[model samples]
Target chain A: MGQPKQERAVQTRSALVRAAAEVFDEYGYAGAGINRILKRAGLTAGALYFHFGSKEGLAEAVMNAGQDTVEPLLESRGLQRLVDVTLVWAHRLGVDPLLRAGVELSLGHEDFADGAPFESRRELMAGYLREARDLGELREGVDPEVVARFVVGACTGIQLYSRQVDGRASLPQRVKEMWDCLLPGIAAPGTAQDFDTGVARGERLGRMGAQA
Target chain B: MGQPKQERAVQTRSALVRAAAEVFDEYGYAGAGINRILKRAGLTAGALYFHFGSKEGLAEAVMNAGQDTVEPLLESRGLQRLVDVTLVWAHRLGVDPLLRAGVELSLGHEDFADGAPFESRRELMAGYLREARDLGELREGVDPEVVARFVVGACTGIQLYSRQVDGRASLPQRVKEMWDCLLPGIAAPGTAQDFDTGVARGERLGRMGAQA
Candidate 1:
């Protein structure tokens, strides 16, 4: 294919993935069909199959296609970075289809094993927690790996409930409240004071989010 | 028409519901079939239909048939009740088919509107939190309703992940870890010290479980 066609194909694939995410996020994997996705993307059947051979393939791409909606707040690191990452992700969970769909697809699908990156996120959290512990930031007797998994689970439960109750309009606030309630136990005394455990804090970081 | 026949009918219905929960928990509502549930229950199609008219009805019954595996810890109350309730529920989520199935059914089904008693659980938690606040057990400026909902969401996410990763064998520890991280932010200063916040705490509570 020519250069223009190659570019067009890529754009079409991206569009389909985005559209598929929206459909799957709303209807889940079982209910999501190629027809609705194509309709949403304003493309033809040939376009979808050309990019993703099947609905499962499209879902797999969507599941793995996590992109940072905004660049991190440069000032944050360690335990604070973990908090910022979650808060920002919560905010985006309200507005971002790809991320939200990945969560929905992962939790709702019964047999789809490659659905959610449960481990990758856990590892990322553990790494930050370890740094926090090493730097004398974390409270004594906390296991980074255990707490990381616990955090991931809590976030998962919160998002699922939030989505069910209100389409996640309240997620950022809920996440902030979560941090407000949780950080005191995990962070060393007086260490969590510097962190702003508020939805506004996350939204500010989101607005300041720049492409990496 | 006889009493013995009615009692036998009750036994069969209980067996069918248990079998259905296991199946629904494994395959979800969309994937669960009447044939498999019947096989698990060792009943005929007629027996299943006689007890639960449809798969949807069976799922609804499974979701509503929640039973607490442990009595509330007597040593815990106020802010501690919130911790015990969550931890106890977490331990049960690992062992109790009814509760675990309820979690699975509620999270997996899309548009199964009469699903998971998420609001009910939040209300229950909020009610407890309100008492905690009235007793001066909660931190200053904390809203029970908001915190209750947030706690529910966090638990929902954690349980979903736990079920997927392990047969929820780590649920008690995970729930305890969650309490360790959260209580500091919600409870009054030094109030959380009374709570054990450990897997053994949940296990001990489980041992004293009684039918209410």
Candidate 2:
């Protein structure tokens, strides 16, 4: 209840979350064990029980924390913001254990409703797309919801292939190319050239994430 | 070998493969155990060893046989054929245990080289896109390989989401919607109206798959 004890508790919880993320990422939800997570964290069972209470609780914590890996792009808007979110997220996925573990856990465990932020992320992107359509940035008759779903779906696939093929070294480039192929379909006529899908801006954003 | 003995051997191998598919589907590649598979099949270890040699070998067998679930669309060509391939595969994904097991094993085991037919499937789809381009189907400057990769990736994501959300009942409709969003980006101007992203054709093709 004291200040120093509260800080220590925070640090312990953080360490447990990190350890759980690593184990879950490596072994998946079914294969991950509580003892292994504790060993990795170098913490006592009492500490884990005090903090997370169970493996399922720890998984929820990881998934909740995963969204924090990529900071919001308050400066960007419309389709540009959507593109930035994915590019920056791709970069972070290469380095962040908690984010990757969150993705793996949500993807591997089909029944867990609060698993990943896929639906929430989809809604967020769809909101931006709606704004884009209102501003005459989107092609006529192009549904924002459909584009949002396709973009999210494409991102999931691109990450999987990039990870399998090259440890995601080419993730930024692949994400950029995905936009290149898709922009024409979603963007208003002759406006596809107005946007930039380059990885440079996203790379800078990712650096900001690291600093934060 | 006598005819009856050879028949019995074939049946034993088939049973082992089916049982392995069930276990791999439920437990994934790492959680799947040889004992569990044997128990499911009501067979002995000798039968498994004689057929698959090891767990890795059984996994390879599952991946190889997974491709056999859908019959090739020899009558269709170009992007239409590509669409047909995905639609039929999506339908089969909901019904076939072997195909779903192969996908789970390949997706879960990142190190397995022969995991899924993703790379091969990409190459195949790219070839069709090339033909489509020559026939004046694709947009100017659109890359076949890029579209191919995106399509494969989108299909993977769609299947995962469909399975998680609706037990894959909506897979056909979702696959069709993916094409609806993508076709405008890939098709030549004015040619976009020529294609059908409907689930009806795919459902018919799925019936053919079942009959085959």
Tell me the spans in candidate 2 whose CA falls farther than 4 Å from its real position.
A1-4, A26-42, A69-71, A110-116, B1-11, B26-43, B68-71, B110-116
Q: What is the C-alpha lDDT of each candidate?
A: 0.78, 0.81
A19-127, model 1: which lDDT tens digit per residue?
9999987776877888999999999999877788888888888987755656334477788888988888987777677988887767666556532478778988898
Best by TM-score: 2
Report how far off residue B139 is in candidate 2 (Å).
0.6
Q: List the residue pairs that clash in candidate 2.
A: none
Q: Candidate 2's chain A scores what TM-score? A: 0.90
| Over 4 Å off, model 1 | A1-6, A42-50, A72-75, A114-116, A133-136, A208-212, B1-9, B42-52, B72-75, B114-116, B133-137, B210-212
User: What digit string (tens of lDDT, one per residue) describes model 2 on residues A109-175?
Assistant: 7556431366787888899999888888899999999888767767877777777777778888888
Model 1, residue A164: distance off in Å is 1.1
- In the order shown, the candidates' DockQ scores are 0.61, 0.55
